[model samples]
Target chain A: DTAVSQTPKYLVTQMGNDKSIKCEQNLGHDTMYWYKQDSKKFLKIMFSYNNKELIINETVPNRFSPKSPDKAHLNLHINSLELGDSAVYFCASSEVRGGAKDRGSEQYFGPGTRLTVT
Target chain B: DQQVKQNSPSLSVQEGRISILNCDYTNSMFDYFLWYKKYPAEGPTFLISISSIKDKNEDGRFTVFLNKSAKHLSLHIVPSQPGDSAVYFCAASDLGNYGQNFVFGPGTRLSVLP
Candidate 1:
């Protein structure tokens, strides 16, 4: 059973085009995240959602938006994609302990979606 | 500025040998650390983790050591097999941000030769 899964593993689109990537997790986790790995191989967090509520929104451009319809799914939508938008996007989920002792909970990642903007 | 750093971009080791991957962080606030292994065309998988409260954490052949004073951590793999060859990433998070702001290092590619 795959714990975390992403659809449209490979996507190639022209500049100014819009695209969306879907992610789902079966780990029964309450927290989900979207990360972008650029050509430099740096995995940076773009957005984070807990129990269908936005918690962390990084300094990402307004063109990228993340939506979590439910606790089990988190999707990323990019508008007016540019050449710099070319990167691999990953979806992750983790169980939060909550309260006082919110230690680092290891995250489970999906296969990743490779996006190319021409 | 990069809060988490993995200096060595790549490391090569022979089969049955021990492989050590080091990571350093500039943020003193970081209290929790984790190591992840990634294969080609796949996402990173959680390997091990250690909290600032402890200096070392062991899980089978994998062990993680944390040096709070130096703000450094290392992952040790014993008898590394060829299958262990992959890109390893070091991630760190603080209690204040919880798991939302996990800063990941650039990653280091490990090659286990037969």
Candidate 2:
């Protein structure tokens, strides 16, 4: 069983076109994240949600938005997709650790969705 | 500015040898550090993590060491097999960040030669 899953493993689109990638986790985690892995293989955080509430937005472009229906799911939407948006998008989740005051930073990641904008 | 960095882009290791991947960060407030391994066409998998309070943590063949004074951390793998070859990333999270937001390094590709 997959702990975290992303839909449409490969997304190919044209410039100025919009697209969305979906993610889901079954690990009963309360937090979900959206990350972008660039061509140079640098994985960076774009957004984060806790219990369906928006928490962190790492100075990402306004054209990009994330919606979380529940803690189990988080979806990323891009408006007027640009060639620069072409990269691997990853979804991750982690539970709130009980003992640690810092919470759990051990994230479970999904098979990334490779988005290509032509 | 890149707060976290992995100076070495790649490393080659022989079987049964130790593979040490290093990471450095500029932020002293980071409370948690983690190491992740990734194979092609897949997302990073968590290997091990350490809290600022502790200097070391180990799991199986993976061991992570943290030196808060130097703002440095390293992942050591002993008896590295061919299966251990992958891109390794070191990540950190600060207490001020929400929802476990972590900053990642570029990554270090480890090739374990048979």
Candidate 3:
């Protein structure tokens, strides 16, 4: 069974177009995250949600928004997509077991979504 | 600024040999370090991690070494097989941040020749 999964594995759209990517996890985890991997293979965290609450919002542009309808799903919506928006997006989940300040927060990742904005 | 860095961009090793990947971080606040392996067209998978309090941690053929004084960490894979060839990423997180707010380093691609 796939622990984490993403929809629309590949997205290609023209400039100024809007797009969205969906992510889901079945690992019974409490926290979910969205990350962007640039052309240079530098992976950075963009957003993080715990139990449907926004916890970490990075210095990302306002064009990108993330919505978590439930604990198991976090979807990303990009507005007015530009050339720089072209990159791979990844979803990950980690459990907060036995409290202890969320120690050993090992994350499980889903297959990435490759986005291309012309 | 890049808090985490992996100086090596790529490395090649023969099968059954040991592969070492290095990573450094400028943030002294970082207490947790992790290594991830990624294959083409897939997201990264967690391999091993070590905390600042410990100098080394081992699991099977994978081991992580942490040097808090230098703020450096390394991942060693013994008897590397072709299947182990992939892009390895080093990530760090501080206790003050929310759970696992990892700062990732630019990845290093490894090629294991059989």
Q: DockQ values for all predictions? A: 0.63, 0.61, 0.55
- The true-versus-predicted C-alpha distance at residue B9 of model 3, in Å, is 0.3
Give Cα distance to truth, residue A117, candidate 1, Å: 0.6
Off by over 4 Å in 2: A98-103
Cα error, residue A35 of model 3, in Å, equals 0.3
Off by over 4 Å in 3: A97-102
lDDT of 3 by residue, A1-118 (tens): 9999999999999999989999999988999999999998899999999999998999999999999999999999999999999999999998764224235677889999999988
Q: How high a TM-score does candidate 1 get?
A: 0.97
Task: Give the candidates in order of lDDT, highest first.
Answer: 1, 2, 3
Q: List the residue pairs that clash in candidate 2.
A: none
- B64: Cα error in model 1, Å: 0.6
Residues B1-114, model 2: lDDT tens digits:
888999999999999999999999998878899999999999899999888888998899999999999999999999899999999999998755556679999999999999
lDDT score, candidate 1, position A101: 35
Candidate 3 lDDT tens digits, B29-63: 78878899999999999998887768999999999
**True lDDT of residue B106, candidate 2:** 98
Residues B1-114 of candidate 1: C-alpha lDDT, one tens digit per residue: 999999999999999999999999999878888999999999999999988889999999999999999999999999899999999999988756754478999999999999
